[model samples]
Target: MAVHGTVAAGFEGVCEEFASFLEREEHDPGAQLVVYRGGERVVDLWSAGVTAESLLAVFSSTKGAMALVAALLVQDGVLDLDRTVASYWPEFAGRGKDGITLREVLAHRAGLVGIDRGFTREELADDRRIAELLADQRPFWQPGQFFGYHGYVIGALVGEVIVRATGRTLQEWYEERIRAPYGLDLWLGLPESEEPRFLSTLPMLTTPEQQAELDAAPYSRFSLGGIAFNEHAPDAVELEEFVNARPVRAKGQASCGGIGSARGLAGMYAAAAFGLDGRAPLLEPNTAAEFARIHSAGTDLVSDSVKQFGLGFNTIAGSFASVAAGSFGHSGAAGSLAFADPRQGFAYAYTRRRYAYPGGAAPENAGLLWSVARALR
Candidate 1:
């Protein structure tokens, strides 16, 4: 297999396997996989027309980034995870949301699952509009009843809280505190300057008939799952287009629109594992431990299976047991995955330009990642 860049110390084999996997998969147009051990990058490899400089839209992997920012605020006393959401953003009290806590929101237990109504691209850009819809919308389930993945709404809820606490958008706060100081290339809200460098994600492979079945399915929780947004809305072009637009981009919806190289994502997890590179610590050891604590573990109402969740990160068990118990990370919509194992003191990130099958059950990608981690162990 051809290796494109430097591999972390003692992890060259891991990168080799990763490169080979990408080649064999073929469906992956481009990809970057990065691993860090003991606060140092041990496996940083790019292959198949991808490079360290390439930026891919990592779907829900953005949630981990959002969680990191929220954890930082909690550490700095800027926000309290246990506090009621209404305490900070009083308007969140509307629509029986007075009891929702930051912990619940992060854990996907705050019944604000899906917006009861459709939102235009204009509404998505308007923070006030997003918040108003959330405030007025009824919960899909009783609050704290069960976990329903907050697909798009999680970003808005978390972003609104961050704004109330810091008076800065999540993107601004993240760029200034996490991205710039740490020298990371990740962006929560992409800027016009970076737009040219952005790689357009390949469209979903599902046929129109498959998409129709997905849309008509009663259990479909993610609004973006199967419907052709542009055709339905007329104004929306593609899901990515709406997600990456300036207004929505400015809000930094942490659930969907994070753009960065795998190295950038891995580096952030590495910082959490080993502290910032010779600078102030991003998270205390105990803070990281707390962040990794399991908050919910059961059949996720949205994902339709028993999965584990911490405050903002997801825990792996059963079928995902390959990832280890203490390991913390999140998987994006398609196949993007980012994880950090404190036990091994390793952080790993993988991103692809193309969308694979929806559920990451295949052995090619997830198996390859687990294989690399196992090799290091």
Candidate 2:
């Protein structure tokens, strides 16, 4: 098990913890991790079967980037957090959703998590199509009355608002405003030239016991969780099936279509909260604070788990104590986690090629993050 890459002084424990975690994996989990304290790169490492340069499907971690774009719009006065979403996209006002605000949607409280009719794979991969379908679809719950993790459709919901307000796609704005200026490896829409570096996300290899646990609690495709992930579609596919498609990677659906290495993920957050490459931080401290404040908490209706969200990003302090509050980022379904812990003065990112058991953030993050946090201390 060859682990590739580097760490600055005081961060050797992070690498050791990573190696220890890998030793227990039953499969080659192919992972990358990169961290930055302020603008300086502190830890940069990856396991075999992946490299520092490989671009893996980052799943919902893409939402962090999408959220950043939305925050930028809010900061720029192009988008208002408190205004009705329908005020920007008139069609969104239909189906008793006229009152849903951008704040609620960003907080995953809109209840327009999915369309009852289900989305075609094509529609799910395209933000515009997804929005069109959802505009007329009824919400499963009263708008703004509750919170559920809108796993797959959140980016489309916000991206539609962005497009309506700016007359530009989220991908286009991301490229010009964030990715290109920072020279980030993370891409909302990967170009043809970058294909060689793109690594398709691998599926999870579950043990029999783990398989049984999943099988025992079967969910109807029409259930809120199932619908959020588009599992109800006639041609429903695994999470990998959607991201592995070259078309999806190329178009880069904002919710989960991003592709990048751990370095990119960490860099994105570092840039947002701290200056990078001799530049000013992308977000003002006031702006970052507003977005990182907890907007939703307690049990998540869709995932049926304890979760919390700020405006558009996941808060860091709740379940994972290693990172304190006032931090923000997101995890992908393939065990990827990326966030900036402003309180701790570092941005951390970990991404896996092989899916971790039970999905979302990988179980190994605790040790890795704890080690990094200790090293920083």
Candidate 3:
């Protein structure tokens, strides 16, 4: 397997590591990796099966972008983190949720994971519809008492807050304030003109043993993880199939509907932390720190495992020790990981075309990220 694209001085190790990882893969895991250092594109590489410009559905990594938009609103005083969600969207105050703050909702503490009856595909892809359904539903737990990853509906929840506050959608705010201004390849909603650039996400190809392991898992459609992902929905489809649809791509549901390349992912974070092409960074240092603070840390109720979360970003410092404290980002279901290490002054993004074994961020990210960290010294 050949690794393509260029790297800046002192970053050749990232290219070698990427190539070695690709060579070890049993399948053609087409992937893209891009990094930015202090407003400069430092590393740009992708495997042969995919191109630099390929727009892949980056699963939950989309959440990082949504979180950024929310952070911007907070920074601008358009939204207040400490304020109750009911203050912005009165309908959200139902069923003991009157006290759920904007901060708690962003931290995945509101427990509005999914609706009583799971959403249809159309409702799932439409932020407005998802919010409408969830506003009246009972939360799974007391708001802020426990934190679970709201896999599918967190965006609809946050987007609803943005809608009630600004009278416009988070998707629209993301496009106007972040994506378009930075010329990011990432899209909250992909227009028809860009359809030709999309590469449909592929499902994981697993061995018989791996398949057996997956089947043996005790996950149920009614379990917290299942409902969080809407597996309980009558019309539920595999996550890969969700964004592969044109309507999902067009709507770009904030939770998981993002479409972009590694370039866009890296660029967005770079613009957030380091500024881009002579423009100012989107977030001030204080605002970034506030969002990156570990708001929730422990066993995530949805995943049933230890995880760390900031306002909306996954705090990376806990798991990846080399990552400096306050480093933040989110990983996608298809093994995409993107983040900004403000302490290191670099932003990194890695995306794969195929679902990675064991899901979440691909294991290779550690070695790849470590290589970049070493090169920065």
Candidate 4:
């Protein structure tokens, strides 16, 4: 295994072992894993073609970043979670959504799960168009009644609210408040100069036989299988277009499209765990406590599996039992994982270019992370 970076103090052996594990798993391409314990980085490692400078698209892991942005605003009294989102962005009041609170929106309980309006890649770049579409859309379920993962809609809702309250787009606010303060390399809206460093996500594999089997399955609530994200045969050309295009990168979809190194992601969580660079708290103690309170603890409507969700981050029970119980973070579509354990004062992040394993359970990269976490304990 080609280890590419040094592990920090007290964790050199852990890093070496993780790199070897990755090699044994045949995890080709690049990946990074960073762990910060008690305000000090103890495990900072990258392997294969990954580097300290390499930044991968961390799909839904961006949700944690978005949640932090909202938490900061809430900390400063610029936004109130209990207040109706319409209280800030009045247009959001349309379609019987006036009762939806910022808390509910962040908690994925606002019922704006799947927008019926089909969005082309181009339409994604226009925030106003997306916001308008979201404002007019009806709830998929009773607001605050259940949790349906709002794949893309939550970003529009939260971003618009942030803009209305702070006079800044979510990306700008994140840069000024979070990224700039910490000198983190994370970018919500990737700049053209950084385009060359970006790694495209491998398309999810699907075959004609698989599609036929999926089509034959009965429509039931508990059924796990369904049409893949790319329903047609895996088209490499379209996959490349989707990942490398500017429209996708510039869209500022907070649920995804975040570009950052694993170190940067780990650093952000470190800042969240401790304070940001010796400044005042990014989130007040009570606010963080409130945010960590689990809101839903059952089968998610979208994933059709049991998931424990806190205010913004998913909880560490059920399938996430391996993670520390109090830990909070988000996982991305293909294998990216980031988490913060306030109890241990530990924060870690792992980002990969190639999709290692499929489905909800953590992949080989995550297993290595768990091993390191256990060793540190």
Error of 4 at 122 (Å): 1.7
lDDT of 3 by residue, 37-62 (tens): 98999999999889999999999999
In order of listing, the candidates' clash counts read: 2, 0, 0, 0
| Cα RMSD, model 1 | 3.5
**Candidate 2: Cα lDDT at 106:** 96
For candidate 1, write residues 257-293 as lDDT tens digits: 7888888888888887676577645788777778788
TM-score of each: 0.87, 0.98, 0.98, 0.88
Q: Largest lDDT belongs to which candidate?
A: 3
Worst 10 residues of 3 by lDDT: 314-323
Across 1-377, the per-residue lDDT of candidate 2 in tens digits comes to 77789999999999999989888876889999999999999999999989899999999999999999999989999998999999999998887999999999999999988888778888888888988888998889998878999888999999999999989998899999999998899999889999999888778888899999989999888889898888988888788668899888888999999999999999999999998989999999999999999999988889888889998899977769889889999988999999998888999999999988898899999899999989998
TM-score, predicted candidate 2 vs. hidden true structure: 0.98
Cα lDDT, model 1, residue 373: 64
Q: What would the per-residue lDDT of candidate 4 be over residues 1-377, giving only the tens digit for each residue?
A: 67766666667667766766766654464678888875677777777666788878787788888888888888888989999999998888888898999999888888776455355555444555667777887876789988867655567678899889878888888888888888886778888888887777654443577567656854532221111121122221232235456766766567666888888888888888676556654666677777777887787776676777777776643345456666777877667788787766678788777654453324665566556666676
The predicted structure with the larger TM-score, 1 or 3, is 3
